[model samples]
Target: MDELTRAVVQLEENQVIEIVRRELKKGTPVEDIVERCRQGMEAVGEKFSQGEYYLPDLIMAGEIFNSILEVLRPIMAEAKTRKLGKIVLATVKNDIHDIGKNVFKGFAEANGFVVHDLGVDVDPELIVSTIKEEKPEIVGLSCLLTSAFDSIKDTIERIKQAGVRNQVKIIIGGAPVSEELKNWSGADAFTRSAAEGVKICKELLES
Candidate 1:
């Protein structure tokens, strides 16, 4: 990666706001740096899943991500595209885990997709309601608990019942979930990680 991208990677790896700020001041487009940071987080996640890293490291990265985002927000506004399609994302009701979702949100946003994060323990109906109002092209449903997975099923059914299923593509994830659940949920696809999820989302959008 280039120096700007490396700076972004450092921001995600360490969440040092000042480091990214200095890089941005050194002539990197804020967008390039932000996207690079998101990629770095994905790399960290890949390593973590492979047992090369730990949760504490991920937590530290997440902290750095938030810190840099604060400085990059205004710069992002100036770099906005015309429209890249919207994606509405949420954790199902009863699931509070969000590290994965947070990482994926950054990836999606960096890729020119407008992401609406609905936070944790989100009810299906709220997701459905948001879909109706936002009319997003994609709905990203995340769940980290096996018991709380009913929320994912119910949300899809509700969207179908609301007659927007065909209009929106669904992507599901989090631990305790599998391709089987994706098939069962009638979703377009399932990915083991946020990195893969973003890839699937891009494919779905392009296809």
Candidate 2:
């Protein structure tokens, strides 16, 4: 990889916000840098899918991706009249692992989502209450374990039970859930990887 690609890849690995800003000052096009990051994430996702990389590496890549986004998000915000949409994100109950959660949050934020993170081991009731209070357009339920998939289910049911199911889109993911599981849970979508998941959410938000 060249300097720009290296910077973006390293940026995703290191979460170097300053490095991205410096590259922007070096006359690198923001679009180019963003695209480079997309490539880096795709590569990381591929590695994960191939079992060549573990969860920590994936999460680290996410940290890097979001760090640069912190610098660019304001620029995008300033240029655009409105963002795609706000979202509430969290890892569900009994799942203290936040590696995937952080990665997904990074992807969402980098994709221009204003994310309200509920943090690890999040409760279904709390997730519902946040929607009632924040009124975000999307609810992203993140679980890193098959054991924690119930939290995703419980969270979705709470949305229906609270009668807010019609108001917000629910997207679920983590280590074990599938698109079919997402459907089974009555969620709008399930993404296998963070970057592609953001694409789906962005497309849905735009539509």
Candidate 3:
């Protein structure tokens, strides 16, 4: 792991900012810097899965990642000419946790996807309405609490009832989301990793 990746995994916010700024000054490609950060985040996720880290740690890591993005946003904006796709993203109703959702948003945006974020504890009707208005190719639902599984299922059902389900692919994600939940909720895909979620969104579009 490079210093940037190690600093991020160690949750060293100041060092991360310093290294990123130095790298940018040294002419590192924006994509390469972002990839290093992603690698660090992936490692953090592995630690979380191993029980070496907890929810607070994940939240802290997200905050650090966001800081890094703020540093890169201007360069990224200047470099990006086209969007890969549009995604309507939100934390499902009855669940207010948004760290995972925000992290996913960062990865999605970094990968050239324009995201319409609905924020936390969003209603299914609003999500469906946004899908209709934005005409996005994908909808991404996020919830950390397992109790919000029903909200995910209900949201998809509402989309189907609204007759727009076929127009957009649905993806569910968060700590508790699984392939089984994806099946149960009528979603086309599910993932716990932000990077993996972005990959799935791409694959969904290709298919």
Candidate 4:
């Protein structure tokens, strides 16, 4: 593991920031730095799955990743490339958990996707309205609680009822989300990892 990755895994905010600045000064590619940080986040997720870390730790990892993005966003904007696609993201109703959602947002932005984050505990109506207005090519729903599965299904159903379901592909993500849940919720795909979710979104756009 690299210093930057280790610093992030340790949740050492200051050290991670210092390493990022130092790396930028050394002319390191911003994407490389971001990848290392992402690897760290992946490690944190693995730890959480093993019960070595908890919700607070996961939240801390997201905050640290956001801080890294803050440091890189200006440079990223200066070197802006054509956007890959548009995505409307939300944490479903009755579920306020946003760590996964925020992480996915960060990765999506870094990979050239315009993500309209609808924030946590989002109403299905709001999501449907956003889809109508944003006309995003993809919709991403996030939920950490198993109980929120209904909210995911409801949101998708609402989107279908609103007649926009055919216009956009839907992807759901969270600790408990799976192929079964994706099928049950009527989503096109599902992921537990933010990185994988971004890849899936890219595939959705291409296909």
- C-alpha RMSD values across all candidates: 3.4, 3.6, 2.1, 1.6
Candidate 4 displacement at residue 28 in angstroms? 2.9
User: How does candidate 4 fare on TM-score?
Assistant: 0.92
* Displacement of the residue 123 alpha carbon in candidate 3, Å: 1.4
Q: Write the per-residue lDDT of candidate 1 for residues 42-69, one digit (tens) a residue.
A: 6667777899878787777777776666
Give the residue spans of candidate 3 off by over 4 A.
46-55
> How many steric overlaps are in each model, in order?
1, 1, 0, 0
Per-residue lDDT for 78 in model 4? 75
Query: Which candidate comes out best when scored by lDDT?
Result: 4
Q: What is the TM-score (0 to 1) of candidate 1? A: 0.79
Residue 29 lDDT in candidate 1:
68
Ranking by TM-score: 4, 3, 1, 2
lDDT of 2 by residue, 1-41 (tens): 65545654443444345556777778766555676666676
Q: Estimate the TM-score of every prediction.
A: 0.79, 0.75, 0.88, 0.92
The Cα RMSD of model 4 versus the native structure comes to: 1.6
Question: Is candidate 1 or 4 superior in TM-score?
Answer: 4
Q: Candidate 3, which ten residues in sequence have the lowest lDDT sum?
A: 72-81
Scored against the true structure, residue 46 in model 1 reaches a CA lDDT of 72
lDDT of 3 by residue, 43-100 (tens): 9989998999998998899889889889888876787468899999999999998767
Judged by whole-model lDDT over C-alpha atoms, candidate 1 comes out at 0.77
Highest-TM-score candidate: 4
lDDT of 3 at 141: 95
